[model samples]
Target: MGPLDRIEELIAYVEAAKAVPMSRACRVDRGELIAMLEELQAELPADIRRSEVMLAERDKIISAGEKEAERIIAEGEGEHARLVSQHEITVSAEHEASRIIGEAREEAQRLRDEVDEYVDTTLANFEQFLQRAVSGVERGRDKMHALREIGTFNPPEQEESEEKPLPQF
Candidate 1:
């Protein structure tokens, strides 16, 4: 029987013993009690050893579980850090892109303004040139009309030996 069963038998044996006439004691067989006690003593060490082995196994299981938990926590923290770093990089990149785009837009607008101003100035200069040309042509016609009225509308013929070039506007 196990130690507990043996202990229960010992209790029963003590309870079933005859009571003394005037004392609060009982009449238990000494030999029987001693034998039971010896048996209990013999079984205790083996039981204690088994309990110790179970406790060691429990400790090993707990240690492994604690190590696994620590590893998982560390891995999770690393992943979180990586994700945060990636997010920061993305935010920085977006801001940089926005700044670059803004600068490019401003540059494009400046170039367009410069081109418009150049075209306007060029057109104004061309208009002035055209006006001067028209004035020259009108003055030449007036001179011709006056000459015709005075009866001297003849254009001079150039001699082949001393040819002269016509006047240029």
Candidate 2:
């Protein structure tokens, strides 16, 4: 039995025993005292067994609930970790795309600078060629004037080089 019930049982036994004492103070019949003790002994074991069953049932329910709670907690933690991993992969992809775009832009700028340099060099070379052409025309004019003054200016009709005829000044 529980502690309180054990105490009560003990007290009852003490009372019955005291009553049965063939003493002057608390006199009681012997047969009645024997009956009381016998009844108490029989009832105590049943009471103790009932209390043990109740405790066992309570413990079983508590342990089952605890196992269910642990399963739910483990599932929630797994879901959280999966979401975090997916987010990290997404962020990494975005970072890589940004880096590649930046590199492409830098390469485009480098090519543009090279094109600008080439164009400037070509224009300078074309300008020098035009100046040389004008100088050659002036020299040809001076040669034609001297030949006319001497009355001895006769050019061969055909030239070996495949070129347009120089203008006679």
Candidate 3:
């Protein structure tokens, strides 16, 4: 029989026992009660051992779950750190690229200004040289006209003493 049934039987036995007159004491067979107690004791250890085993299994499962939770939290933290680092690197790279582009534009503008200055200086010098050449040509033309008007422009005649004879081939 189960422990509960044995306990009920013990309760019945005590209730049917003889009561002493005017006292809270009762008379029962000691040998029979001892035998019943021995049976209960024999049944108790197997049930207690099963309960202990179940409690141990529950503790093991709880420990494993806690360990898994810790691992997942650590992995999440590592991923967060890596993403933050990548974002910082991207932001730094963007700023550096902007700085480089700004410097390149400034340098390009400076070069353009230098080229324009050189071109303007060269054109001015060429204009001055052309003006001087035209002025010299005009002066020569004026001298020729003056000589013609003064009748001093003459065609030279070759004298016989100064002429050279042609060579016969």
Candidate 4:
């Protein structure tokens, strides 16, 4: 029998013993009780060793679980760091693109202003040249009318060699 069963049997035997007269005591066989106690003592060490082995096994399992948890935590940390780095790179790329776009816009504006100034200056120069040419033509007409009134004007035919070629643009 196991220690527990033996202990129960011992208790039953003690309870079933005859009561002593005029005393809160019972008559138990000393030898039987002693034998039962000795047997219990003999069984205790083996039970204790089994308990110790079981406790050691539980500790080992707990240690393994703790290691696994640490490994998983480390992996999570690595993944988090990688994601953070990737996010930073993406943000940096976006910032660089924005900077480049801003610079391009500024350059385009500057070029546009330069082109507008160039066109305005060219038009002003062309207008001045046309005004001067118109004035020259008016002066020549006045001289021709004065000559006709003085009776010295002649509508002479021009020779091909006398003709001036038009100016190239």
Per-prediction backbone clash count? 0, 0, 0, 0
Positional deviation of residue 54's Cα in model 2 after best superposition, in angstroms: 2.6
Residue pairs in clash, model 1: none
**Could you give candidate 4's per-residue lDDT for residues 56-150 as a string of tens digits?**
65556555555655555555555555555676576655555455555545654555566556555655665564455445444433533443443
- How many pairs of residues collide in model 4? 0
Cα lDDT over the full model 4: 0.57
lDDT of 3 by residue, 10-51 (tens): 667766877755544456676786687678668767655655
Give a tens-digit lDDT track for model 1, residues 3-35: 656666666776687775554455666677768
Rank by TM-score, highest first: 4, 3, 1, 2
Give the Å error, residue 85, model 4. Answer: 3.5
**Over the stretch 1-169, how does candidate 2's per-residue lDDT look in tens digits?**
4333433443444444333123322333436544544554565466556545655655565555555545545554554455456865765555554555455455545544554565456546555544444454344334334434434434468757777898998
Q: 61, model 4: CA deviation in Å?
A: 2.6
Give the TM-scores of the predictions, in the order they appear: 0.39, 0.36, 0.41, 0.41
**What is the lDDT for 44 in model 4?**
58
Alpha-carbon lDDT, every model = 0.58, 0.49, 0.57, 0.57
Off by over 4 Å in 2: 1-23, 88-169
Candidate 3 Cα errors over 4 Å, as ranges: 17-29, 88-169
Clashing pairs in 2: none
Identify the runs in model 1 with alpha carbons over 4 angstroms from their true place.
15-29, 88-169
